[model samples]
Every structure is written in structure tokens, then in C-alpha cells.
Target: MKKKFKNLTFKDALFNIANYTVFFLFTLACIFPFYYIFINTISNNDAVQKGMINFIPVGINIRNYLALTSVNDLGVSFVVTVARTVLGTGLMVLASAFIGYLVTKEEMRNRKFWYRFLIITMYFNAGIMPVFLNLSMLGLTDNFMGYIIPSIIAPYNIILVKTYIESIPRELEESALIDGAGYFMVFRKIIWPLSKPILATIAIFGAVNHWNSFIDSLVYMQNAPKLYTLQHRLYVYLNEASNLKDIISSSPNAAAMALNSKVLKYTVTMVTLIPIFIVYPFMQRYFEKGIMLGAVKG
Candidate 1:
């Protein structure tokens, strides 16, 4: 590599510089939002409101976070979010794999019909009004079921898993079947193990979706505040925090109240995003490999 670089022309050097510059800018652009949030979260409330805190935190402060700790429903939202993320991701991955595997089986009756049916949904949008009405009809409103059921089986995820499963040689499962292993046994002992990469990839997708989703919670759980997810609760806090002017006017601790909402907003954002940030690095390699194998290899 050093030898090749030594022989490079001016044009080659220019191209290399341009490539590095573009990537540097892109990386900065991606990182800036988090940095801005971090600096603001740590900075004084007045600094944030005056647009004084930028890339660097101007004045160190933790009052906003202190106030956030005392806020109601924060703990409840955290529990709801964690429960939904774990259960929803597991169920989604299993359902995706089951649907994906079923479609690939040549012997399954109506294989073509099922495959085409699932694929068609991807290209179509069953608008929000219809989806909400259907959920309401099913009595999912004002319940945790509203959070999990709608996203439990994603068509795109199923298609990805299906492609990954198809790439796996079928002879192993067939051999296991010939040896008297039932379909479930073959799937349990063979298919699932081989499909771990793609499953891990889809697991991240499902978990992120479940954790970040607030629209479902808003639309269905408005009447059931106990069922609110962390995102929804955070949304409420952010909105209130942004209106510090109103809060200061009515509060006894007008001086302290001014900083509470704004600071809490930034802290809440960090808290909400913490899980994904913590888990992502570990899953990234598998996610990349799975995407290539499941979505591109076929």
C-alpha cells in the first residue's frame, strides 16, 4: 500500500483528499447534534436559551437534571419502554423468522400466495386512519397490546429473513427430517442457529423501532397514561420544558423553574437514547454482515 501511494499522481492525491474531506464532514455532521445536546444538557439554562452554548459547554450546570429526577412518570415510562423493547423485539424476530421460513418451504400449501401477499404489503400503505380504526376495532386502544401488536410482524424484516434463510443450504434440514426429526425440531436445532446473523440484525431493527415509537402510544394510549412509553413521556416533558416562559410565570420558584424544563428536556433526550447508543457498537458488525447477506447476497 505504501509503495502504491508513493507512485500516485497529483490527481490521485487530490481524489484521496476529496474522499477524506467528504467523510470527515459527514462524520462531523452526524456527531454535532449529539454534541450540541450534550453541551446544552450540561450548560446553564440561561446559556441554552440565549443560544450561548454551541460546540462547547459554556457554563457547567446540573439543575435541569436534578429537577428531572423528581419529575413524575419518568420511572414508569422507563419500565414500560424496557418491557416493550425486550418482549416486542423477541416476538418480532421470531415472527419474522417463522414467516420467512414458511414462505421458503416448497411443500407448504399456498406458498406462492402467502409470499406474494406478504410482499405486496411492502409496496402498499394502509393509511394511518384505517390502521388506527382497525386497532380500535380490535380493542387494542388504551392497552400495552397497542404498542406490540402493530409492529410484531414487519413485512420487510420477514423478507430479509426469508432471503437469508434461502441462502442457507436446505440439505441439512432435509437430512434431519429424513432422520425422523420433526419440522419444529429441525427448525430449532438447525435453521435458527444458522440464521443468527440475520436474526441479530433484525433484533436491532425491532428493538429500535419498539423503543423509539411514540405515535402508537400517542394515538392509542392517550386515554391510558399508565401505558405511555418513555418516548411519549419524554415528548410531554420536552414540550413543557420548551415553554419555560409559561412555567416561570405560575411557579413559586420562578428563578429555578426557568431552568428546569429546558435542562430536563436535554437530559431526557440523552436518557431516552442511552440504550440504543450502548447496544449499537456490539451489534454493528453483525448488523452489517446480516444486511449484506440477507438483503444483498440473494
Candidate 2:
């Protein structure tokens, strides 16, 4: 066996080596940044400020975490972020899945027109000002609905899912119909089950998007601090810390307080990132399947 393996062509050996090299390098590149951030986040403020820490933390401390969790609105913001990510992602996935299934049906009337309409929206979104105006008209501004509603239907995801569903053999649908299964029954029992890979992909994408979304929450729900997401809370904290340092510089105690703010920033960033990072590994296997689902022709 060893002799036979060694006798493989030079071209095959070279290809295998090159493939492994590229894969190793790619993995290192992806992991290094997060490792660097983790090291820096744990390092003391003075060590971080002096650039003394690299792959390993220097003068390690948990004071940053203490400062972060001790902040007035951090708890509220955390709760809001969790709720928004779950609800928003759930709604988007359900809507995208149903719409994707519908649009993939060749027998559906005006399927081509609906597909073109969605493709158009994917390329040409109404500007933000108009979106805000429309939201204002609907009284969704400064509410939880504002953040969740606008993100419920992503055209790009719908298209990806549609492509994946289109790859499924139509013979399956015909067989189900022959068995007297209605359209709804076929979709729920057959199509949805078959479309798991794409659905998982869309779910992960939507969940990550909603979890990391801060700008929309900031712009639309500005008036509702109670509804502020983690990102928005971090933004507000950074702004407040900056302003406080500037205003309170003449006071001795305030200067020391601002030194702590630097630590808090890194800690809060780590805290916000940790939950999402933890969830990612669980979805990693599904993610590759989902991405590749629509790429290959059936």
C-alpha cells in the first residue's frame, strides 16, 4: 500500500501538498485576528496602551469585564439584543422559506414576473430617507417593530433559497401530487424537508445579520433606549465615555474614571462578540452545506 501510494504521479503529490498548504494558511488567517483580539481584551489597560501584548496577554486582568457589566444599561441592552436576534431571524427565515418555495414553483402563475420583481428589489433598494419616511407613516419608528419589520424579508436570501429549491427533482413533487397531497401539504412535508440545507444557510445568515445589526436599531429606535441593542449600547457608551473624559478632565477623580473607560471598551466588545462566536460553531457544519446547496447543478 505504501509503495503504491508513493508511486502516485508527481502531479497528484504536488496538488495534494498545494491544497494542504492553502487550507492551512486560510485557517490561520481566519483564526489569528480573533486570537489577537482575545489576548488584547484580557491585557491590562496600561499594557494595551503601551502595545506590550501580542498573541499572549500581558498584565492580565478582569477589571474591564467588571466595568462593562457594571454599566447602567448593559443588562437591558443585552436582553434587547437577544430578543431581537431570535425574533427577527425566526421571522425572516420563515418568510424567506415560504416565499422561496412559492417562487420556485414552475406551475405558479407569473413566476417569471415575481422573480424579476424580487431581483429588481435586490439591486435597487429605495433610499434610506424614503424607507424612514415610510416607516414614519406606518408609525414603526422608535419601536421594536422598526428593527424587526425592515429586516423580515431579504431578497438576496430568498433568491438563494429559490435557486436551491429549483435544484430539487420535480419528479418528487409530481409523485406527492399523485398521492393526493395538496400544495400546502407538499410544501410542509416534502419541500421544506428537502430544503434543509438552504434553510439552515438562510437561518444562520439572518441570525448573524440581526445579532450584529446596530445601525438600523440606532437610526430607527433612537428614541427608545429601552429597546437599544448591544451595538447601540456600546456606541452610546463610547460616546458618553469620550464626552465625560473631555468635560471632567479638570477633576482628579474623573481622570481616573476615564482610564477605566478604556478597559471597559475592550471588555464590552468582547462580551458582545462572545455569544455570537459561541453560536457560530454549532451552525458551522450546516453553513457550508447551505452555501454549496445552490452552487452545483442537480
Winner by TM-score: 1
lDDT of each residue in 177-205, candidate 1, tens digit only: 89999988887898899999999999999
Candidate number achieving the greatest lDDT relative to the actual structure: 1
List where candidate 1 sits over 4 angstroms from the true fold: 7-9, 59-63, 242-260
The count of residue-pair clashes in candidate 2 stands at: 0
Q: Residues 43-78, candidate 2, lDDT per residue (tens digit)?
A: 877778677777788877665555444454788989
Task: Report lDDT (Cα) of residue 51, candidate 1.
Answer: 79
Model 1, position 111, has a per-residue lDDT of 94
Cα lDDT, model 1, residue 82: 94
TM-score of each: 0.89, 0.86
TM-score, prediction 2: 0.86
